[model samples]
Target: MAASTCVRAGEISPGHDSFTGSPSTADRLTGSVAVDGQRRHGGSSRDVRRGRPTLVCPCLPVVDGLSSGRLDQDEGVSSFRKGDHGEPDSVRFEAAGLRWLGEAPGGVAVAEVLSEGPGWLETARVHPGGATAAAAEQLGRALARTHAAGAPHLGCPPAGWTGDGFMGRAQLPLRGTPGPDSWGEFYAADRVLPYLAGAVANGAIDTAGERTVRRCADRLATGELDAPQPRLVTRPAARLHGDLWSGNVLWGERDGIVAATLIDPAAHGGHAESDLAQLGVFGAPHLDRVVAAYDEISPLAPGWRERVGLHQLHMLIVHAALFGGSYGRQTVRTAARYA
Candidate 1:
């Protein structure tokens, strides 16, 4: 029963300046946790790779096994450990999402993934620092490139990803329906309404709030929110981080300045605006700079600003489903704007 050290050298700090972006928050909203312990042993790199699980409990024997010393030397070992209820396949889905999006042409920077199994995942640890305007701008351009990578269709999962996906702890279906023919329809059916229904079922939303959201859905169904395109969306479905809240953005210092590295992505294919709007969810630093830079490279549609709330509705309802508090009220208020 050795106490687990949640962080070690090269690990992201647990503070406002770290991954969560909230200086006062504790657990990561992104649902990632790291485990390590203090112990030393002599083993080859392969031995360390095979011995990572033992590191989760420092009390384990070191006589013939792995150690952080060996792992650190590898320079590619993930700096954290996590386990779920014996269903490790979810971690594989997440790992695949990271690789598929990270390797896309001109993709945004992402945390390096070391390994993944049925119920565990390891990723290269990142040490975070303060945000910089330059870093925000760079992130914007990088995000533009990522979104521009495009996808086979809206609601498509990352290449090689199997089964339904997730956003934070909530299930996210990646399978797209045929003949939707418009972004508004895809979003209303696949993103907005499903979470809205969950929120209602869970009593997170009141009758009045549900009515407001339904009105918004009706508008979406009629394609009232579709950009200037006819029969098709004006913008193609872009690769999305799926969840881009500020906490998931790890800011790191390099050469005495700040830059961002993404982690815990719920990556999928969706409207690029969905990603952009989510950045402002908990509020990322230098947000204006990020948006300006993004516009410079891949300008948003005319009236995108007016549509920000539309895109944000999905996450807001998700929060209501998972937390069931102020988020629910906010969902109604946001939907009212469109209603």
Candidate 2:
């Protein structure tokens, strides 16, 4: 039995996804997450499907993978949840009065200390051992509520751009945007292109493959990609959990729960649907329920499913960067079939 660190600076570990030597994980961790305060494992996607783990920590929101942040160890109520496209960067430790400290010895620093309530984190729960259709509907409604939270005041820049995705700092330059004008531009620049460079640098992809990414990025940039105008948000950019997948959705029937804040986010602003589509891609529990829920709060832009292949390619490329070529190949296949 081994344990893994996760979804954020390694705090939200999966049951068996990451193993560090022996069957046990060291309790001590660096930077944030208030080391040892609480170890919350939101179970795996399968667990959620069965309707187990119905009880969710109101303070913790479910999320996709992990990441590292950029701040040195300090203390405050992280305005955002530390994360990236894959996993969390830094673990955050917050003291009273909004003081925050962080540690991401594993990677970069991910901390946006803030003390306010997390309305966007949204609801997350796992169905430890049950399967109820109503639970699915409940989850659906909850997600809709999260999307309806409206744009909040911004603090840090909305970003998922990482130099790590590049070959030894051979970063792909994205046009400077204090923030993006639309979700399409933001996703194209940050998620799609940068990860392709990282995959090339990591040897998962060749220069030729990288060219495809450039082609894709260029298309979106020029509005030439054969696709509809993304339901991409323009004004306010809108806060989004940079990575959203099946594991991020927790299945539970929490009464009176309006929404669950997005925790462990590679937080930024772009198409909120990015999260929804991702959920569908990874087969998040009660996916139909979540979509139904989202629709109630605010309807989805049409033809969202068809774009899954397009959005999922970004995630696969990211995997290639962090792991290896298979993900790259998978990405290429998807691109050939879709956008």
Candidate 3:
């Protein structure tokens, strides 16, 4: 799971197709779809198979065997995907997370889940044409609302998602302390320190780099970095799109309105600012507008901007552990800033 990267749902093109006993020209029109059977549904490829035209859907590349694309039906073109793991529990966890986030106040706009079963999830397709400043601003505002929705504690998974969550393809353990003194502590213990250890064991981070990270991690644990009032925004655990990089923010227009729709969430309860900081990880377009809008709705704490790199350390280290390259160096640099 570490090697897998999450896809940005907005950039994908959508179409729809269904599998039923046979190969049809309609099936060919829907690229990237796979079906178990070979028999055609209506007629042979040569026949028009009159009455209704078969819908061809587009599929997105997900980690392992999970495939996402569009499905055609009278209701509308729905976003659909099939999971690699044939377990209902796996699909249920993600589906539950998406639903929880979508239902939150100023909630996120997510692809609607139509139906899900073992090894498969079907959803309403989102066609993101491009990112716009207006959309970015709206995203920021809504994100604040999402965070304000709150959680039981930091590191907690979305309601109903009891199983371990994921970051990309890597399994991420989701557990929270009864009540923590500071966000830094939980982040260090659950997010940073564990990944650092794994990176060191895999030779991704050399001994010296590992030592440096440990120092920063120790500081995190001691709560030295914790500045409760000014530096951090104290709030109930806010709902977080655990992975909020730009790619996950899908941009699209509907009814002449453009907006950012979130996809591929690693949703959880955590500091709202952490989700905001993640936007800068890979550089989100119109980030300034997004931040400004968010701040207007839910004012951020003083010096929150400076903490961007601090929050980003978790993802950097995760990348280092998984990709094993210059990412390790980048992680250390970010950690050193706060250390």
Scanning candidate 1 in windows of ten residues, the lowest lDDT window is 37-46
Q: Ten consecutive residues with minimal summed lDDT in candidate 2?
A: 93-102
Top TM-score prediction, candidate number: 3
Measured against the true structure, the TM-scores of the candidates, in listed sequence, are 0.75, 0.54, 0.78
> Hey, what RMSD does candidate 1 come out at?
10.4
Segments in model 3 whose C-alpha atoms lie over 4 Å from true places:
1-63, 86-90, 176-179, 227-235
Ranking by lDDT: 1, 3, 2
What is the C-alpha lDDT profile of model 2 across 1-339, one tens digit per residue?
113333322111343222111112222111111222211223323322442222221233334342222121134211222322332222211111012101211111222244322222111232133325565555445444433332422222223332221211122232324455544565677667766756787787777667666666666666444333223233353344445543443332235333222233444334555556555433344455555655665565665555555655655666667666456665555555433
Model 3, position 274, has a per-residue lDDT of 74
Q: Tens-digit lDDT track for model 1 on 1-339?
A: 111224321122332222211222223232211122111112212233344432433322232222122223254433643434334455566787788779767767887787666665666655556678889899988888888777777888888886788775578877744437687888888888888877887787999999999999888888888863211223456878888876667787557767777866788878887887777555567777887788887877787767777777888788887667556777787788788
lDDT of 3 by residue, 29-133 (tens): 123112321111111111111112345646544445455444566765534454546334555666777898898866668767788877666766555456777
When 1 and 2 are scored with TM-score, the better candidate is 1
